[model samples]
Target: MAQRVFITAGAGGIGKVIAETYAAQGAQVYVCDQDHRALESLRDGITGSCVDVTDEAALDDWLQAGLAVLGGCDVLINNAGIAGQADPVEALDLAQWKKCLAVNLDAQMITCRAIAPVMKRQKSGAIINLSSTSGLFGAPFRAPYAAAKWAVIGFTKTIATELGPYGIRCNAICPGAVSGDRMDRVLAAEAQARGVTPQDVFEDYASGSSLRRFAEPEEIAQLCVYLSSDAAKFVSGQAIAVDGNTETYHSV
Candidate 1:
């Protein structure tokens, strides 16, 4: 049987690549994102709905619809996240902080809650939660994002233990400075917060990694595929980093 995979925020950015990668591997892929246009742009073999993860009812509807189409989910990738505010903690807005946690942390739990029973019945499944290198260390100007990502690692581990007895695996992927429009926007925000040029911030970020460069979205996407495959059947409760070994997150 073709593996049935579902992804969150899979309409664009890194999530789109992950979805496409699974589809290429002959998996039945279903994704949800808030961007209607981006969802429309998805290629053949991949299907998605425009959904805001923060809206529980809407998210549930998307998941139910996907479950109906795919029959059962063999893999779930919680890839929806935002960089949140690029400012000091004291300077952050309350609403923005809540929104960050809502998307990055809460939505993962929501999806897991809905899918756990289905996986339990089958006695086999894989769950990959997207974390960040920031979750492993301090991200100077991105407090909310860092906090939520850190929580993701803990959540991943906890669920791994809870689901292990039933043959379900859960893991967290911590990517660092992935090269793309998203990273460009993140660098731009950090630059504005630190009163420096985006190029300078970009250089600083690249230098922080031992590889001296950012990771490509394909790199992260490939890891997602691996973690859900039979090859990684024994890998669970691991917070693997796709980050070229980050050394620091210093500002320019």
Candidate 2:
């Protein structure tokens, strides 16, 4: 049977690849994104919806429609997130901080809360929450993003325990410096803040990883695929880092 998958931010980046990968594996993938263009760009195999995950009403509406079309859901990839305001703790914008938490942390919880009963009824499901290396290690100037990710780990663990009895598995994937447009933007911001070149910032980030390179989006997607499959049936309540064994994110 093809699995039903609900993925947040499936229009681009890591989320896009994960949706595509799952669809390729014969899963019924439903993706939602705020970017209409990106949503439209998604391949025909996956269902796409325009939505902002931070909004509970919008998310609920999207979920209702997608699950209706999908029949039921077997997996959820809480892949939506933002880089947030890049600034020191003292200089951080309160509004941006709140918005970051609202989208990255609170939204994931809301998503699980809405879908718990559905998965529980099914008697089997998996939840893969996207976290970050920053969650494991403190990220300088990206406290809000880090904080929200850290909370996700705790959130995933708690849900794994709560939903375990119902046969629902919950886990987190932590990626470090994923390559693409988002990383470019982050490096640009870090460069501008430190009065250095983007390349310098990139090198600093890569140096922390044992592989000394940013992970390809597909790399993260593969992990999601495995976690959602029976291949990882016993994996739950764990935070797995897809990073290249990143030692730190504080260099430079």
Candidate 3:
């Protein structure tokens, strides 16, 4: 049987690639994104909808509807997140902090909560969370994002422990500077704050990793697939990094 895979924020960036990858692998994929136009553009193989995960009611409705169509969800990828602003913690906006947590961290809880019973009934499931390198170490100017991601690691472990006996495996993918438009924007912001060009900031990020390059979204997608497969059946409560081997979250 084709795996029923549900991914959050799959309209673009990493999520989009993940959705396409899973679909290509013959998984019955369902993706939800905030961008309606992007959702419309998804390949015919994918089932998609415009959904803002920060809205609990909307998220629940979408998940419930997709579960009905897919019959039951075998895997879930919590891929929705925002970088927030490039500012010191003291200078960060209160509203932005809340927004960052709303999507990056809290929304995953909502999705997991909804999917728990279904997976429990079936006695098997896999959950892959999109955490960040920031979760493992200090992210100077990106405190809000860092905090939420670190929280995700703890949350992932909790789910793994609680759901392990039921055959539900949970893990986190902590990606380093992913090469894309999103990274470009992040570099631009960091560049402005540090009085350097975006290219310089980009170089700094790449240098922080041993491979000295950005990780491709397709690579991350592959990791997601591996973790959800039978091969990784024993893998749970692990925070795996798909970075070019991220040496540090800090630029230095």
Candidate 4:
């Protein structure tokens, strides 16, 4: 039988790829994103909804609505996140920091709380969260992003512990420098912040990776799909790094 998969930030990037990969594998895929237009533009076979995951009530409603359409959710990819304020601590905007934490950390907790009952009732499920190398280490100018992502790892582990008896597995994926428009934007932002060329920042990021390159979204999607499948049934409370050995060399 096909599984029902619910993915946050499913409109594009790694989220979109994850949805498509699972759908191709015969799962019923439902995706949620704040960008309605982008969600609507996705190819066939995906059920997309507009959801701002940081808003607890709004996200709960959206998740419930998705469950209704999906029949039930066997897998959830907590992929919604933002590259929050990037600047020195003294100049960092509190609003941006709070907003980042709201989406990247708090929203994950709220969504898990809302879905735990359903997963427990069903007696099985898998939750895959998107973390970052920044979460595992320190980044020079990404205090907010790092802080929230670190929290996600801790959150995933805690839930895994509590949910294990219920047969609901929880794990996290730490990806490094994924290639996409979002990555381009990040490079541009870093360039602006450091007063260097975009290529310079890209080189610096790639230099630490063992592959000497950024990962494609499909690569990360493959890992997510595997974790959601029966092949990884015993995996839980693990933060798997999908980076090309970047964490070993890079502090962030």
Candidate 5:
């Protein structure tokens, strides 16, 4: 039987690549994102939907509907998240923090809460969360994102511990600066905040990593796909960093 995989924030970037990777591996893949048009543009092999994970009802309904169609989810990639406005905590908007937590942390919890029972019944499953290098270290001007990602790491471990006996494995993928539009946006934001050119921001982050280059979205997606597969059946409760040695740099 083809493995049934469900992924959040799968319209583009790492999420989209993850969906494609699994689908190519003969899994039935369903992907959801808030951008309807972008979701539609994804290849036909994926089951795509426009979903705002922050809306509990909508997320639940979408998941239920997807489960019904896909027969039961064997794997879930919780990739929906937001990098809110960059600002110091003292000047940060509370709403921005709340929103960041809503999508990054709370939404993943909700999805896990809703799906764990199904996996428990099946007695086998894997959950791959999209955390960040920031989760393992402090990131200036991104307190909320960092906090929520840290929460995701903790959440993955909790689930892994609780569900380990049930054969449900949970793990997080902490990616370093992924190269793409998201990187461009982050670079632009950093440039604005630090009064440097985007090129300088990119150079600084690249230099921080031992590889001296940003990771491709496909590279991150490949790790996620592997974690969700039977190959990683023994792996659980771990936060694996695909960071190219940036862990050495504690700075944001």
Candidate 6:
């Protein structure tokens, strides 16, 4: 049987690549994202709905509807996230912090909550949560994003232990400075906050990694496919980094 895979925020960026990669491997891919146009533009093998991950009710609805169509989910990837406000901790806004946590952290919990029962009954499934290198190290200007990502690692491990008896595996993927429009926007924001050119900020980020370059979206997507495959059935509760061996975090 073809694998049934569900992904959040799969309409664009890294999520899009992940969805497409699964589809290419003949998996039944269903995704949800906030961008209606991106959802509409998805290729034939991939299907998606417009959903704001922060909206719990809407997210639940999307999951239920997807479950109905896919029959059952073999893999669930929590890929929705935002690069929250780029500012000092003292200058941060409470609303922005909440928003970041809502999408990056809360939504993952919501989806996992909804899917756990299904997986438990099947006695086999994979859950991949997208974390970040920031989760492993201190991200100077991105407190909310970093905090939420750190929490994802903890959440992934807890669930792995809780679900292991039932044959469910959970893991977190930590990608650093992925090369994409999203990273472009993040660089622009950090640059503006630091009063430097975007190029300067980009260089700093690249330099932070031992590889001295940003990761390709396909690189991250490939890992998602691997983790969800039978090959990685024993790999649970691991916070794997795809950041080209990050040496240091860029400073403000």
- Expressed as tens digits, the lDDT of each residue in 85-203 for candidate 1 is 87887899999999999999999999999999999999999999999888888878888999999999999999999999999999999988788887788788879999999999888
lDDT scores of the candidates, listed in order = 0.92, 0.89, 0.91, 0.88, 0.87, 0.92
Candidate 2: deviation at residue 157, Å?
A: 0.3
Taking all chains together, the TM-score of candidate 2 against the true structure is 0.94
Ten contiguous residues with the weakest lDDT in model 2? 243-252
Give stretches of model 4 more than 4 Å off.
Answer: 191-197, 247-252
- Candidate 2, superposed: residue stretches over 4 Å from native: 191-197
**TM-score, model 1 to reference:** 0.94
Scored by lDDT, model 1 comes in at 0.92
Query: Per-candidate TM vs. native?
Result: 0.94, 0.94, 0.95, 0.93, 0.94, 0.95
* lDDT for each residue of candidate 6 in 1-252, tens digit (9 for 90 to 100): 999999999999999999999999899999999998899899979988899999999999999999999888999999999888888999999999999999999999999999999999999999999999889998888899899999999999999999999999999999988888878887898789899999999888899888999999999999999998889988999999998888887521
By lDDT, the better pick of 5 and 6 is 6
Clash statistics: count for each candidate: 0, 0, 0, 0, 0, 0
RMSD of each: 1.9, 1.8, 1.7, 1.8, 1.7, 1.8
lDDT of 4 by residue, 2-99 (tens): 98888899988889999899988888888889997888788778888788887888888988997787777899899999988878999999889999
lDDT of 2 by residue, 101-127 (tens): 998998898889888999999989999
Model 5, position 132, has a per-residue lDDT of 89
Off-target runs (Cα >4 Å) in candidate 5 are 192-197, 247-252
lDDT of 5 by residue, 99-186 (tens): 9999999989888988899999999999988888989988887888899999999999999999999999999999888888888887
How many clashes does the backbone of model 3 have? 0
Query: Runs in model 6 with CA error above 4 Å?
Result: 189-199
